[model samples]
Each structure stands twice: as C-alpha cells, then as structure tokens.
Target: MQTITSARMAAIDTNCEYLGIKRLQLMENAGAAVASAVKERISSGKVVIIAGRGNNGGDAFVAARHLGGYDVTVILIGKKEDLKTPEALHNWNVLEKTSIPLVEFTNSTFFDPSILKNAKVIIDGIFGTGVRGRIHEPESTIIDLINGSGAFVLSVDVPSGFDPDGGEFDKAVHAGLTLTFHKMKTGFLSQNAQQYTGEIRVVDIGIPIEAEFYVGPGDIQPFLKRPAISHKGDAGRILVIGGGPYSGAPALSALSALRAGADIVTVAAPKNVSDIIASYSPNLIVKKLTGEILVEDDIPIISRLIEKHDVVVMGMGLGNADETLLAIEKIVPLCTKAVIDADALSPQLVPFLDKNMILTPHAGEMKRLSGNDVPDEQKERIEFIKSFAQKNEVTVLLKGAIDLISDWLEVRANRTGNAGMTVGGTGDVLAGLTGALFARCKSPLEAAACGAFINGAAGDMAFKEFGYGLLATDIIDYIPAVMKA
Candidate 1:
C-alpha cells in the first residue's frame, strides 16, 4: 500500500543493513514471489526467462530453479564472464546444474525464434532500476524482438531499458505484467511507463516498515482524498479572471480547475466573451465584466468577485494593456491566494509578491518576470529562478523541457511532459489547476508542485494517443485519468 518514489527505494536499499535484512535474502524473496505469480498464471507452459548480468537477472535464475519441472529456458543477454554482483554469480552457478536450456547472446549466434515460439510466458530481465541512458543497439533489437513475438511478457523488478526515476528511454520491453520488488518505483506511475508495463504487481520482500518511515509519506495524499459529507462550497471555490479575444482559453482554464477538484468555478470575462464561456460549460458561472480587456475600472468588481471564491486564477488570454497591468496590481493584492500567468506576469506587477501566490510562467514569461536576457540553459535558469522565488517569498513554476518549481524551502523538478504540450492554452489549464489546489492546500508551494506534476502527467497521458497533435483541450480531458482514484 506504500506509494514511494524511486529515491525512496534507493534509500531502502542503502539502509537494508539497519533493517536487519541481507541483500541476498531480499533477492531470494523477490524471486520466490515472482515464481509464485508465474506458476499461478501458467502452470505448465514453456517459460523463457530473459536474464541480464545484474540482480534482476539473479531473480530470474531463482525462478528457473523453481520452474525446473516445467519446460523452462534462460536467455542471458551477455556472456557468463560479465556477471557483476556476487548474488547474480551464485544464482548462475545454481541454475547451471539444471537441464534447462541456456543461451548466451552474442554477435555470432542469432536469437532463434523457435526457443520462444511455444513459450506461454516470457520474463524480461535485460535491465532494471540501475539502467541508465538509452537502450543500446542489441538491447533495442532484443526489445523489438520480444514485442514482435506476441508472447505474454512478464518483467522482473521493472521493465528492462526504462529509467527508474525520470527521463525517457529510446526503447523498453512491453510487458503483459511487471513484478516489481519491495516498493513501486516512481516510473511505475508515469504515463510513459504504461506503454511498457501493462499491469504492475509489487512484491514485498520483507523490507522493514521503517524503510517506508525513512522517506515519509508522499505529498499526493491531500489531492487523492474526498470528504464523504462535504458540499460543493466546502470543497473550494475558484474564480478565473481572463478571457477577451481568446475566449476558449478562459473556458479551458475554468474547466480544468473544476476537473482538478474545485467544487465551484466562476469565469469573469467581458460581456461578449462571457456568453461563449458559459455555453461551453454549464458548471461554470460566468460574470460579465464591463471591459474587453481587464481595466483599472474593473478592479473593484473583480475584488468583490474574488471575495466569494477561495482562490483566484488570473492572466490566461489577458491581452497586454496599461489598464490590464493596473488591474492586476489592484486585484493581486486583494486576493488571499492567486495564480498569475500569461500577460499578467509583466515586470510592472512584480512588486506585489505574496507567499500565498503562485506564478505559472513559461520561459519567455519567466524572462519578463526576472528581467533577464539570457538564453535558456536549465541549470542556470533553475538557480536564478530559485533566487527570484526566495527573494519574493512566492512559489514560481518555470515551464520548459523540465518544469522547475521553487519556493524558499526547496526546488522540485518535474520531468513528466512530452514535446506535445507546446500547444497554446495549456498554460492556462495549468494556471487553473494550480488555483484549484491553492484553495485547499496548506501552502502555496505544495499547490504549485502538485499542480505542475498533475498537469504535466495529464499532458503526457494525452500525448500517448494524440502524439504531437495534442491540443490544450486534450490535456484537460485526461486530467481525470491522471487524478484517478
């Protein structure tokens, strides 16, 4: 039941000695659990266990020992001489005594399809949590072969060739079932991981409960729970103030806020655009403001609207104007918590920094906020952004190849999006999502981190079907998928 990140798993491994379990015993338990799962699934099928040179392969070897009565074969991706860990070598020695067929992958010998033609189950052990970079040529070829074979593939620990924590791999094994050890890795929950791992099963290998206590529970619980007796107003109210020429943008933001668990959503737009926004979503309560663009005259009315809502989302599709700048200055100071994005992130409004506020700015908007003319380099930008957020006592989410979220305490990097999110209005959706969470969250920093992670994950999910053609609306559609119970 423990939901842990990859770093937490590594910490468990490093602190195993203190938990009173040897590494060898943990590996044994892992293999036995996997073997039990295999035996339950296919009683007498021809089993082909793909073995690497790591501990993951060692688990496969142990499973082969238990499956000796059945028709089983082990395929080692590398030569026997290249075996790394002591546990892996010990398992290999024990497996060699059995009559089960063994094959070493090499340039001279071609992988015979006949070996796996009748195999009812295929075990993937090519790589595991320790895998880094892209899958090399031969491994990529192996993954392709496994995928094309149409066999029921079961991956041990994790699907081979996938990164344990972050980053995308060139190729990975598409497993019908994945048997992960101890705790679930962060990659197991990602949209990209779903492409390779069909169904995930976590095996508890007798790791101490203290192992989980070390990392503490993840911060996602607050977003997952629902109160049974709560009403619409109790959940939280969100006010979205943006929409003029780009009418669809504000609607997208408002809907996303509702989708991200906001109970009541109100869109404040010009009279001409309010009708269009209201027509798009019946859940939205649109308030028709007097001006086409948010002006100074609209500030008093906007402040009154902000009082009813728990949080406010500003700056999506807000056209740049002197009146807009003045309106933002007055409105920002009045709201308890606000999410500022798009044209509302101008330098003129930088002085009103509230720790309760979150700013969702893309690279260009970030440059405007920081008044920096430098080119985009991730490390340099993150450092500068952290300094900016700390100086202002606000949370800033800098959107780019990898999203960097910062406040005074810490900087968390989110690597969960595809290039498909470059479409317009996605930022508006993100701003709305942040605003929704901001209403319920204890701090602005948590809201920002959770919002970025959830939004990027939704975008990643949308990218799977739509690929590069993913629209902003597609991201909003998949928000429920990412935020599933």
Candidate 2:
C-alpha cells in the first residue's frame, strides 16, 4: 500500500525510460486500462473525453481508440499544436487517423457544453498530477461542465484542477470513479478526497519496480533545474578535506565537485601538497593548512571552513596517520553534513555517526568500518548494507559493480558504471559528486542515489569513447553532459 507523491511518481516515470520503457508504451497501457474500466460501468454509449495537453490527455486519447463500439469523442482543451508532451502529440496524431470524433476548444469562449450534453460517460483528463495554483481558462469551464453533466464520470489519473500532492485546490472536478495509474497518489489519502474521487482504482501500467529502486536520469532533474534568480554558492558550496600523502586524490575530488554543479569548491590540504593540488585547477580555491599533513592543530581552521560551506567532502588521501585520524575524529563532530570516504572510513569515526553524514566505501572499506564480512550474494549484500546504514544512523553508498545506496529505511541500486571505471581517482569523483548533491537534496538517500547514478553514468559515457583507457578526469569532463542529458 505504498503511496507516491506527484514529484516522485514523475521521477519514476523518467527512470522507467532510462531502463528502456518508453512513455508512449505506458500511455498505451493506461489507455487500455481506462477503456476496460469504462466497459465495466457499461458496454457502449456516447462517451465524451475532456483532455488537456499533457500525458493525462494522452491517456484519454489512447482510451478513445480502444472504445470501438461506443460513440467516443475527444474534446481537447487546447489546440493539437499546444500539446505539452511528445507522447500526447503522438497519440493525438493516431486519433486523427481514426474516426473518433475530435473537438478542439481553443478558449473558454469556444467551449460548447452541448458536446457533453449527450455523454452517457464523461472521462476527465483535463489535468493529472501536474495541476497547481488556481483554476483558469477552458479548463475551469470544462471542469464545471463535467461536474454538472450528471454523467457517470471517470477521472483519468487524477481529477482536473486537484492538487495531487498537497490535496489542496481552488476548484476541481468531481468524478464518480478515478482510475489512477502506477500506484495510489498520496493526496488521495487526504481528508475529504473521497468526495471527488468516488471509487478509486489503482492500475498497473508496466512501469518496472526497478525504476523506483534504481537511480537514473530522474534523480538528477530536480537539482539541475535550480532557480534562475539564485546567486553564487546557491547551487552548492563544497569543502574538500584531503591531500597529505597524495595530492591528486584531493584535486580530483575538488574538480569533480565543480563539474557536478557545485558553484564553489575549496580544497583544504596540507601546506606541502597545497601547491600541487592548486596547480591542478585554477578554478579551485585552495586552502593551505599549517603543516605537512592534517594534524590536530588544523581543526580550528577546518571547523570555520565547514561552517561556511554547504557540505564537506572528506577523506580522499590523508593517510592513516594517528594524528590525521585524530584530527578527523574531532572535525567530524563539527560539520552539519559531510561525505566521509577513503582513509576517513575508520571504525573510530562511527561513534559520531548521524543521519546527516554519508559514508562512501568500497567492499574492503565497508568491511573495515562495519567489522563484518561484505556478503558475496547480492541480496545478502543489499540487506547487509541496509543493516549497517540503519545501525550507524548514516547513509551508505557502497561502491561495487552494482553500487548500493541506503539511508536506514530504504535501499537503491545503480548499475551505470563499467569495468573501465576500475581505474584510479573514480571513487574520488563519486565522493565529490555526492557532496554536491548532498548540499541540495533534502533526503540523504536521494543525494547518494543521484551521486551514484551520475558518477557511474559519466564513467559509462567516457568508456564509450576511451574504452579501458578512460581516466577519472575523463569521467569528470562528462559530468555536466550527464546532468544535461
């Protein structure tokens, strides 16, 4: 009995496409389901469909084709050119080839109530999960007509003008039955929802369950569509703390953060390797620590920097020096949010674990931190990761051929990376990418899922061109492209 919000449902829809299921196929299944529901009410009659310009309308268009015996007529709320989605347009084109009478109401002035006057059944598809704000135009007029028609009303997905997420709407259609796709919407559980949605029916439209469980292109959209009015550092400000023994590790992380849409990134490393790390990218804001390596003395400066940045990407290559680990133990408690990785994945840091922290660990690192063997079987491994995350009170992003991400309650997997990603510095790229997403997303699980998908997808893209010779920097270069796609 899982209920999904409109936004999360939209993400799952996109993820389904990433997994090779096209939106048009789902629309066909939905239309077939709607047509079946109509047949249940009555075999054949004059059926009038009120459709908008989105996928909701597309579903209605599909239903019209299946409703062969009945006199099915489609009343489009807008012009065919005004269709919002390609799937909707495609269905409209298909409907045009058929004899299912099509009527277009370009404006409220042109809307004829007589079309619905004879409808023995009215299918409401004017709006679905995308409805927001007050009612307007031909939609408002059509909603009223549907509610007053006294016909046996069947709402497609959600009733028109109803807020599918918050269950708040200024004006909405009252339907005798609602055929919801995929799963039940959360808003339907709201008080007084039954008044509009008479009898609710959940329809399976061929969206694979893996689409919800796996991270894909869907997870990246919300973060990428930042406000145009946003200022500097609004996207994300990341602080990378690493680079005592190896300079390249921290540099890779800082650069990857920038490519992953972090507005600003500062790499704080030991003074000895600061110059080399800084030389890697002029775009990086390098902070020089007092000594040759991370020590207890640097805590004061690091603490202040953590306060300024949105999230901390720590432990790329500080080595296992007692003094360095001790410094990390103290620094972990100061940050509100962080991505702890590599040498920072020590058992000692577990005492400070919280929901705000994300630990990125390979199988070996996970074993060391959890004091348990990383299971060989996939199901056992997934359960182990979930148990470890729940016990530690932190999100775990376990790196492997199949990346597993979990935040106590739920687990997600990403299978985007290839064998070529076994190359060095790739994990550093993931750590930094996770930090950038962690700064923007409300859920640590979502941030970790998105990070794993984007990082691995970029590697897959780079592998296509460079094969096994792909470098971590090559993956970094493709980060923005993955986000854009």
Which candidate number maximizes TM-score? 2
Q: Which residue runs does candidate 1 get wrong by more than 4 Å?
A: 1-218
Q: Show where candidate 2 strays beyond 4 Å.
A: none
Q: lDDT per residue, candidate 1, 1-485, as tens digits?
A: 44555555665665575456677788788888878888889879788888898888888888888885788889988888878888888888887887878888875668776777878889888887878876775677888889888889999988888776756777788999998887777777777678788899888888876444322114444677788888868778999999876798889999999898899999999877889899997889999989788888887788888889999898887788787788888888898888988878998878897888889888888888888853578768768878899888889988877777888566776666788898988888899998888888767877887788788889988989899999999999998887776
What tens-digit string does per-residue lDDT give for candidate 2 at 4-35?
Answer: 99988999999999889999999999999999
List TM-scores for all candidates, in order: 0.58, 0.97
Screening candidate 1 with a backbone cut-off below 3 angstroms (N, C-alpha, C), the clashing residue pairs are: none
Looking at model 2, residue 386 earns an lDDT score of 89
Residue pairs that clash (backbone atoms under 3 angstroms), model 2: none
Candidate 1, residue 320: Cα displacement in angstroms equals 0.5
